[model samples]
Target: MSEAVTHSVPSASTSPGLLASLDPLLREWLPRQRWFAGKGRPVTGFSLVSATEVLPLNSGLGLLHLLVRAHQPLVPTQSAPAYPADCYQLLLGVRETLPPRLAPALIGHPTQGPLAGLTVYEALHDPRPADVLLEALRERAHLGELRFERDMAQEIRSDLVPRLVTAEQSNSSLVYGDTFILKLLRRIVPGINPDLELPLALARAGCARVPAPAGWILADLPADSLGPGQGDPGDPYVLGVLQPFLQGASDGWDLALREMAKGEDFSGAARALGRATAEVHTALARALPEVTMGRAQMEVLAEGMTERLTAAVQTVPSLLPYAPGLRSAFDALADLAGEGQTWTAQRIHGDLHLGQCLRSPSGSWSLIDFEGEPSKPLAERRLPQPTARDVAGMLRSFDYAAHSLRAEGTQVSAVSGWADACRAAYCSGYAEAGGRDPRTDPVLLRAYETDKAIYEVVYEARHRPDWLPVPMAAVRRLALPEPS
Candidate 1:
């Protein structure tokens, strides 16, 4: 759909040494790459260790996968969530190996000729890698073989191969043509992912905001140190899962932003979004835990976000601003968290935001991206917390949409009006479904919004510093009472 063509590097390594010829490729590729979030910065190291053929030997031309491993460990020195050391594991996809006559010009490519010098092939033209990976997944396990525990359901499609669709730091998404979006977990941890879980539960409860699962992928990872009370013999980590890839969906984050950028009234849509939120939470309450607004859980969340902020800052020094006040803010907020007028605990969208939601073709909204913060460990993500956490996430997303588009050269006109409409629509919708009153909880909402804004400001600073102004704007807008 996007006019941007995909340029893939070889999957396996090309040679033991770092290929000097690839220096130009690496430099040019990194900045334009969607997967590598650290684009603006220079790469510290780029090397081609060796090559491995994933498919059968004579699989086809351009299938020579050179696992190009590059590392650039630079911490941000900013006043927000510090950046962390992130590794770029590129699966280079070359289309065709050139003739011996043109080998000199294309040798640096190993398989295909240079983009500008000679004729070449783009591996995406064939789409075999996505195919091989899917075949490996399906026959690897049967429908009823293993307990489908990761909160996802599965169904096989006989039509197409899995294509790599999305790339974030911790996960890579593979979409098999139209059938499914298989999220391959990177930097995995022991046990199931919460994103995979909450959606499945919502689906089971007949909630409509989620993209229902067809099935999922799990792995029996090595667990040398078994926890004292953990179950399962060898199923240590959840590798990934499969969900219906919305073939024609607009990013809710974008929709919200475009509205804000145009300054259109989004209050109606905002109410609808709110209604959907309440419905999902209600469904979650019915499906997961007995709603208990308790202190123990709040404390756990406080500790977790605090540590995440610290880690994010250490990795990217650009986010150093919020670090100094993170702990004290958490400590102060933790008290207000459990002592709310009335707290209701339920299974929540670990990572809820506009990006996590999709606008269906019919103008209906559906949430995706179940994985909470991609950086958080799996075990911590599975913990239950306030639904307000999810609420804060979506609100922050509204801010993100507005800011991201302003960066896209879109004119800023009635942007704030659209944002207001979205809020109205979402809130009205959410309140109707949850039996809550938006008018009655201004202070409570303000506090949660502030809490979330601080986190968002730090998060944006780390990932999209250009977009940091979105959350910063939110921080300026919120009416948080100073600690007495």
Candidate 2:
């Protein structure tokens, strides 16, 4: 737990009419953001959940923190279910006129709000406001409902330079002098986020495969705002996380692609990554409680997978043909459970893929990002799941890397062989490190892989139609009988 101290608060300036005046501008700007989730749906309106004046606008440089709810029309399909309004976190910089250097961060000048006639841009893009956020974390400042806390054991410098990372999809990241990277979650959910919780737990367990959380920001919300039975009063939402940035580390996805393009073997790196993943899993098991999943739990899991497949087929008609074969994989796992087979369930990385890994210059591998599937509910993402789920996700990632660079309608035998070799090597490494081979449980592994493939199919169909064929190929393979 981090120590917190109250800081001098700014005068309240965010009134109910503030969001109403900014509504028109936000509706246009919010959808254009890369981190915005509701891309297809039109933003109907905005509701201000909470707003704080981080710095007074009387100064030339002002910072305002906002938590606003975006209302959109529900697009319910068999595959995609209806969801409630989404809350977003915004850090806005106020200036009388925009500077040429900060033109790209411009969110447009609001003509109707308290901030009318002032240019409001992304604060993270500016070094001054970004530094303010880091300083708050270093000081453990509690400004109103927003609290910035840091690991007492870790020392944070006051003079690191801040630069906003541009490639992020769901969240915004600011790298501070290659020493620390702060991930500010764009979507706001009122609960303990696994991204912060798991990393802190791994650090406590002395897991070197994951970066330790040096500091974090949280927002306290009313219990009633969280809805009934969601959480107790005073459960703070994880707003951002600060972690040590591994200098000279390469993304696993980029590394794999480079190796594949050169026709060089990536099995050794893949094997090392598998070992690192197993180490993280081992540490997570040690830090968190484990449970034995019984027949009832197995049935529930299988049923959920089946339902997802049903929905996917409804939305992506291409999946209709392979539905039966995919459903069989889930059925096999349920059958094994019916026969009294059980597996240990613990907190595993919910969304494990090559993109979530980093390879240091020294050739050591480290896993990053434990946020799980961003589309899932916070409670579900925090649930204990079978380790095979993560293994399946990585396995699919290997396959994706193999096909990612291939041309359309090209023969897949060579790339498929490469993916197969990497997969086998990874599983072998995991067995050597974790003492359990994922391949030993064929039924369970196949079920998880199939479920992951189904999820890929749905995601690709919705987001990247061109990439749909990649997961569709896996769906075709998983739907077939396993080699005897």
Top-lDDT candidate index: 2
Q: What's the TM for model 1?
A: 0.67
Most TM-score-accurate candidate: 2
Worst 10 residues of 2 by lDDT: 75-84
Q: Provide the overall lDDT of each model, using Cα atoms, as 2-decimal numbers.
A: 0.57, 0.88
Residues 140-159, candidate 1, lDDT per residue (tens digit)?
Answer: 53221112332213556557
Extract clashing residue pairs from model 2: none
- Models 1 onward score TM values of 0.67, 0.96
Q: Evaluate candidate 1 by giving its C-alpha RMSD to the native, one decimal.
A: 8.4
How displaced is residue 146 in candidate 1, in Å? Answer: 13
Kindly list the per-residue Cα lDDT of model 2 for residues 1-484, writing each as its tens digit. Answer: 4566786666645565678767887999999999888888889988777788888876889988998889888776542322367889999999999999999899888787578889989899999999999999998998877998889888899989999999999999999999999999998788889999999999999999999999999988886453345566777789999999999999999999878777788899988988998999999999999999989999999999999898888889989989999999999999999999999999999999999999999999999999988877788899999999999999999998887767354444456588999999999999989999899999999999999999888888878998888898899999998787
Residue 300, candidate 1: alpha-carbon lDDT: 65
